[model samples]
Target: MTQPILVIKDMSIVFSSPDEADIEAVRQVDLTLTPGKTLALVGESGCGKSVTARAVLRLLDRNANIPRGSILFQPEGEAATDIARLKQDSLPLRAIRGNQISMIFQEPMSSLSPVHTIGDQIDEMMILHEGLRPKQARERTVALLDQVGIPGARQRADAYPFELSGGLRQRAMIAMALACTPQLLIADEPTTALDVTTQAQILDLLRQLQSDFGMAMLFITHDLGVVAEIADEVAVMYLGDVVEQGSVYDVFARPSHPYTQALMSSIPKMARKAERVRLSPIKGTVPAPKDRPVGCAFTSRCPYAFEPCATIRPERTEVGGGHHARCHLLTRQPVEAVA
Candidate 1:
């Protein structure tokens, strides 16, 4: 079996409040991303998808803390570094963050610097990480922009973030992310803001780049359609905990968790006129972190939730062929049987 490029084990994130008790945003969660594969973290807003991705690079805010778990990143031919344990500003982390790992944030308009030209921003990464001279870095930056399908790459390199269209700005961000040929790329809803056409182009660009570079990717999105289009593996998150995970095919074919089922049902599907039905939106919204339930985080919204689901947390139960879901339904033994 191929070794995973990144492994997250029992990871949890918390935030300290001055007057209130600490808010635990993420619970014990486990995930693995093999080299050259994409793992999509799917959930609604505030489900901790972005927080988990940010944790990989130690990019959380000052008040955020990792109370438990380890984020192990092992680039080929290098020793594994525990990102959770590394000091935020340590030299080792600084060297690895942009060199071996890179991220494409959701909003490029705000993420990219307005003062600096796109060329300068990308060139700086090479100059800092690859130790390339200014001329060499600039040449490489132009090549990267061209490689990502940017027209008039050399001229666009001098353009400010505000000067380009949303699609072009996103392309520039992708160019910057690929400047160093990072081993791992974390894309947090990179296509959410773009129109359908531009979104498809970005997705294709990412696929081509991943094929060329053989980079592992952690893709964060709430779109199941995108997951079907891009991801090899899928992990369904509710509140903070992962409720179901497996190869995209397996999970989509047989979603065991009620929450996962609800999400799958919510997708707009085509049907004959006579067979068409209304979309089934899940009942209720995701509770705030402090209001999360004691047992299953999804119990409140799950239509199939029963007595034990409200009091006894279910462990991850194997479905088949490496598929697993955290729900009492999969356990086979009913509440009456246990009682």
Candidate 2:
């Protein structure tokens, strides 16, 4: 098997309050992304999906602390580098951020500067990351816009972000992300604010770009439908921990974690018939980071939870090749019990 391009081992993030209380936003999360594959992080709000994504790029806020773990990036044909230990002033990451690992945010309107022309914005990245001359960068920027399926690339490149439609803005964002031929792309809810048609278009575009560049992708999303469309592997998170992870087909077909089952069942299906296919909403909201439960965070919502689940946290154990889940039920009882 090919070696992974990015490897995150036992990564954790904490936020220190003014009162000196620590809020753990992420706990012992491990993930790997190989070239030409995509891993989707799926969960509800406050499940630490976004925090995990931010940690990969070292984009966390001021109060956030990475107390332990390593984010190792092995650039193509290069030695492994620890991104977590790199200093802020160091130019080592400059080659990685836009040039090797690009990111597309949820809100393009907020991510893109309204004052700058689309072409100029993309050219800025090319200049900084690739050191292309101004004229050369502008030429490549227009081609990138066209490559992303933007209509009237020459004219549209001159328009400010505010002057473009939502779909166009998203395409522009994709153009910027692909400007430097990155080896990995982190997409944080890239289709959140768009309509259904536009969302489909953007996803299709991403898949095509992934194939064209053969770059690894870390796609963060809450929607299972979106996951079905893009992910090769799926990691289900709950309140800062990965509850279940496996190939997309196995996780969706036979979810071992109770939380994963609940999420899958909630998706509306047209073929299924019932008085009403009841959507199983997880009982309570995710616990606040400051007040995270000691044991399994999903114990309160898990139907199969027993005494052990409430006190002793479960270790991630392999149920099948590359399929793992964290739950006491997996340890104590037969896998049949949870299934």
Candidate 3:
């Protein structure tokens, strides 16, 4: 098999409060993104999906620190380099951020500068990462907007982000992320706030762009429907850890972890004609970072929890080829009820 474009081995991120207590926001998570594939990090809000993505780009604030593990990146034909250990000032990872790896955030209004015109915003990265001259960068920027399906690209380039509609702003953000033609794109719920039709367009645009670029994608979303549309693989997260991970087909069809099953069951389905569809919500709220559970962070809400599950954390065990789940029930029964 070809080497992966990015490899995250046992990556952990912790936040230290003024009282000196450490809160693990991400715990020993491992993931890989190969060329021409998409990995969806799915979970409820505050489950550390976004934290994990930000850690890969070293975009975490000073309050957060990487406690363990490494994030390795291998450019198409280059030697593997450890991005986690690189100095902030001398980060060679910059070469990957916009040139080889890029990110499209949830809110375009907040992510794109209000002061900068759409064209200037996209051109800035090209200038910095690709070293393109001003005029050349502008030309590419216009093409990028058009490529993302934004009509009247040349005229819109001169407009400010606030002046554009939600969908247009998002398309502009996608254009900016693709300006450097990155090999890996991290999208953090890029369609969270858009209308349904706009969301569909954005997702289709992303899919089309992924095919055209053949870039690996780490797409973070809470919507299972969106995952079904674009993900080749799925990693279900809870609290600070991945509870289940496998091919999109297997994980969605036969979810092993209680959390994974609950999340899938919660999605509103269309085929069923029952008076009311059953919604299995994982009980209880996500525990505060400062007060995480001792064993499985999801133990409080898991229906299959036993004494061992509450006291001893389960390591990720292979359930099948490329399918793994962190749960004690897998040890007891081949299949068990999640709710």
Best by lDDT: 1
Q: What order do candidates take by TM-score, descending?
A: 1, 2, 3
**Residue 336 CA error for candidate 2 (Å)?**
16
Per-residue alpha-carbon lDDT of candidate 3 for residues 211-292, written as tens digits (9 for 90 to 100) = 9999999999999999999999999999889989999999988999988888877877778757577766667888886677
lDDT of 2 by residue, 166-215 (tens): 89999999999899998889999999999999999999999999999999
User: Could you tally the backbone clashes for each prediction?
Assistant: 0, 0, 0
Question: How far out, in Å, is residue 231 in model 1?
Answer: 0.4
Better of 2 and 3 by TM-score: 2
Which pairs clash in the backbone of model 1?
none
> Which run of 10 residues does model 3 get worst, by summed lDDT?
75-84
lDDT of 3: 0.88
- The lDDT of each candidate is 0.92, 0.89, 0.88
Q: Which regions of candidate 3 are displaced past 4 Å?
A: 75-78, 333-339
Better of 2 and 3 by lDDT: 2
lDDT of 1 by residue, 1-339 (tens): 788888899999999989998899999999998878999999999999999999999999999999899998883437888989999799989988878889997799656899999999999999999999999999999999999999999999999999999999999998888889998999999999999999999999999999999999999999999999999999999999999999999999999899999999998787634776788899899999898878899988888888788788789889998899999888756337554
The regions of model 2 sitting more than 4 angstroms off are 75-78, 273-275, 333-339
